[model samples]
Target chain A: MINYWIAGIYPRNAKLIESTRLYDKTLKEQFKKEKSRLLKIQSDNKLDFISDPLIDWDDNLRPFTNSLRGIERGPLTRYYENNTFYRQPIIKSKIGTSGNILKNSICFDLFNKKSKVKIDILDPFTFYDLSANEFYKSEEEAVNAFAGIIKKELISIKNNVKLIQFNAPSLARVVERDRLNMVKKAIENIVRGIDTKTCLNLWGSDISNTFEEFQEFPTDIIGIDFTSTRVDRFDKIKMKKGLACGLIDAKNTKMEKSADVIRELRNIKNVFNPESISITSSWDFEFIPESFADRKLQIMKQIKEKSKMMKL
Target chain B: MKKFPLATQEIGSIRKPRWLVKLLQDKNVSDEVKEEARSDVALLNLKLFEDIGLDVIYDGEARRVEMYEYSIRRIEGLQLAGKIRSWDNKYYNKGRCTKKVKYTGPYHVDEFLFVKENANRMIKLPITGAYTLADWSYNEAYKSKEDFTIDLARKVIRPLIKDLVKTGADFIQIDEPAATTHPDEMQLVVDSFNESIKGINAKFGIHICYSEDYSNMYPEVLEMKNHQYELEFANRDSWNKGINHSNRNGYESFLKTFREYGEKKEIGLGVLDVHVDEIESPELVRDRILYAVKMTDNPNLVHVNPDCGLRTRSRETSFAKLKNMVIGTEMAKKKLQL
Candidate 1:
């Protein structure tokens, strides 16, 4: 089986852009309308799972930052290598979840109540690494506490959510190989009792050497950026879990050919046979413009249709 | 050159007057109305900075919409895709260069000449730097980052700068907020900045704002062709009143690192935290200044200013910050009895 969905905040259209800037009464109206429009766009294109554009989120870290008990929104920090910026989550005291962490994140009022929803959260290690840890005593303890926080967050949203995606752009930046096991343990802790499917998406770094370590992880799907990591990097590893191949470059305005994407995916499927194959974006479409992001979605749909013809 | 021990200058921008902002944003307003409004605001801003006892000031960049768009819109061969958020809901119109970009005209020259005509104090022309232009834009045409930045310097920025210098604009402040964005590309910044002022005989200083650690630029930044480097320090430091190493901890890396290089370049020490409206007391600003001076062992090498542009703050708040900055510098000077 093959699945398709997006991972991060989609680029805002003209209406959403204006409404967000104004931040008036029209903000909620525009947001609800925009969410429906995005879900419809994906539904019409035949994506296996659908999600809100995350228009309400300032970034992926907002939900946790806003809902967590002991975290404060700190000064603006660069979001990875991109031009985008986000407030660093400052840990002030012992971590605790106060309310529904997904209250602001997932909106059921816009959904059909039957949509296979996909939610993206910063992976525990990446969250721990990106955060300013003033309270935690050790790296292991902080990461475990973060994992517990994510587990609690997932447990609340598990009943309706179809896929819980953990985006780990900083996962491959772990220099010490021993930390890889720690990350694996964190991943296991999040999805331990949750019945829904999950994807552990890793990108922005070539995890060629650590490919073997991820093959045994608890995630049902392990996503990799084919651009950052050469397709042949995982040629030897016969993955136990399914694979999500990030074929589209999200940062640039340039369009990718669907035929080229299918050809690459075909080669990827031939060697490292997994339970299934899924196509995704390299990271967020937030870096690109709205018009270009829509065009990229069209290209993603074409790749899905063409993959059916190959029957690989 | 060091006659003024602690000179003060507005970094780049001041908040546009409310009525002027409205006039500029109005689609029905005539260009004559828009131009007159900007000129009036510019005149008032010059008086405000001067009234605060600033030794050097500009027209507060009232004529241009911003540091980036005003320059980016004037360049040819680059098409603006759409608005993208930098922080909060603040948007910058991102552009893509499909071919070699050239300056459409010297838009800043007229603005510079106008400021010189109005302000009695020493003035600076704050233009966007080449590395920042290349870093902020999507460079599809240029072969490499170096090629893109160099082209922007030699083709776009240098020509406009030559025209400004001809208009009696001797003190040029090149605003490069994205200079140390990529720590590895510090050489590219030096190369492009050096290329921009190759033959021009003007006092060029680089103004770097909020970004990654400026410490990354050091060792490499020393090679850049410029006399002074103005940077933001108040954002990281506290507002407490003390000249000790602990109170002025924000400038610790800067003081320690620059001392290694012998503190040759004049350092623009930021005293006011522009992000907040709470003004730093004169004593606090004095401490921030005294600490930098004590570490450098030369009060002449230090210049005091706000952290970055005051474009986001209200006009009243911006004026207050500058006034306190002047008072604080005076306090520092009195203690030294210079």
Candidate 2:
């Protein structure tokens, strides 16, 4: 039986706020109550990774300070207001490298009673890519350490989770054709013993170089980004593993039609009928509005209906 | 004489005038402080241009931060996280920054606005492309860099470009120095540029530098289907005695691919090297421009500019380089008169 999967861009402030309100009651109580009701609607939709209802106190939410030795003062919060000389900090916590606030936000969503969908964590590679390296000596060391920590945490939460896909968006940055071999090797090392089924989310731009550089790996599935890279290039790549075709554009707020999505899938089906082909979002939909999330779910449902008709 | 507009890639020395440094520090300082800062750099930039005898000018990006640092401040929903060390020993922040669909402030345009108002000549507004912004930023918030880039193009950058075009700007240059980092990301960069320039009727130019590897250039050229053969012999395998076959192979098909990009936009061909401190002779610059002109069918669209910004070089070295470049352009224009 073909298993259908739905993926959207990772949740941002709106999703975080909703998840936080459900977990916290002190926000005027009314906003929290309203957020709970909204989350219930999301729960009824069978969305993946319910907003975690429990708030973790271990997460750090304080403004970044330069008290840490050897670390430069990160960009001021108002730096984004105009052109300035500050670099923003990569806030990570014991739970994750993205800092306490994001980790708590993700955790809050993960344990949210209303969320019934499978949970996928943003991969450690992307986090390490965003991390300030005054602490670590090299990218490999940072990634390995971060992955180890994530693996330990996943062990505790693996039972309730349906699937834990790792987002490796930074994989696109390795441009040296030969460096991809090292990347694949690194990925293999990080994911070697994890129990949960993992998917390596790769951007379309990375696929051309990746195919030329690292041909095959032991991962269960490979997520292809269709929105960023041209769909035509997929015809040239040869994959031995299952293909997670990202047919939906997760960045733009413009809603795509179910027919258009099915058309994109049909094009992929013609190229390679893998062991299993799952349709997903090209990237995270959080950059867009909350309504776009609803549109994404609707698109997933349409894909499911169309996939059922195809009987692949 | 060939009309080569004056431009500088990243230069090294940042010895700011004491008064200007003090003015940047004072928040309550009057418009006079800001104007003085703008004028001081404008005078320096204009002096460099005058000495070089070039038509177009820039204030050398003196009053701003690095491209990524400047943009990071304007994007909302992201916080200052921590720092990452670059290969050059500089520490950069590691945060979930996005060029995605939000605008906290005007960003580089505001900086350019000051430059344009202060400059005596038709100023060139340089903004980092969404692709570079997305490529360099942490993609944790979004699904992929492309997704983040497209969102950035559609939401933050496109709107900003439209606003920039409305500002009566003559030329808008999108700097894609990171184009060589990930060649596959070139299409997204192109798309973002196309989207950003959709409604604007301004003269658009792209500045790419330090892409000696040639691997990044091939994919982009092939994708765009442009035929321009302005190859840099210094970066060839012969330069290193034993040809690094991989680097050699990467550039083998570059000539055919470059032709494709040359067809669309005015190629601001980087005939002058930005990384090296050794000053190139005007004759060599003329030869490079002439070679580029011969390679592309439409030599008229070619504009001689630096390979990248001159912010990384010292004031004297950068001025000398610009002077040579202007002289070369003048000679090339004379030799290849339409």
Q: Which candidate is the best by DockQ?
A: 1
**Tens-place lDDT digits, model 2, residues B1-338:** 23332222222123355567677778998877787776677568756665666556666766665656666666774444433323111334434553335876565566566666666665666776676676655465676667777787778777777777777675766765555565445677667767767766766565554353554555444443222222233222211212233333322344345565444444566655544577877876676666656555566556666655665566677778778877877777787774
Local lDDT at A18 for model 1? 77
Instruction: Give lDDT tens digits, candidate 1, residues B123-223.
Output: 87789998898888876787776888899999988998888888798889999888877788889999899888888988888998666677788788888
Give the native contact fraction of candidate 1. 0.35
Q: Tell me the DockQ of each model, to 2 decimals.
A: 0.54, 0.02
lDDT digits (tens) for residues A1-312 of candidate 2: 334454532332343444443454554443445445545644554444343322121111112222212234332221111111223344333223333323333434424653444545546565455445556666666666666655655555666565666666666556665455655666676566765666777753447545434336556777777776566765644457777777776654446787787777777767756666777777654434445556676667666666678764
Candidate 1 Cα errors over 4 Å, as ranges: A230-237, A267-275, B1-3
Lowest summed lDDT window (length 10), candidate 2 chain B: B234-243
The 10 consecutive residues of candidate 1 chain B with the worst lDDT sum are B83-92
Which candidate tops TM-score?
Answer: 1
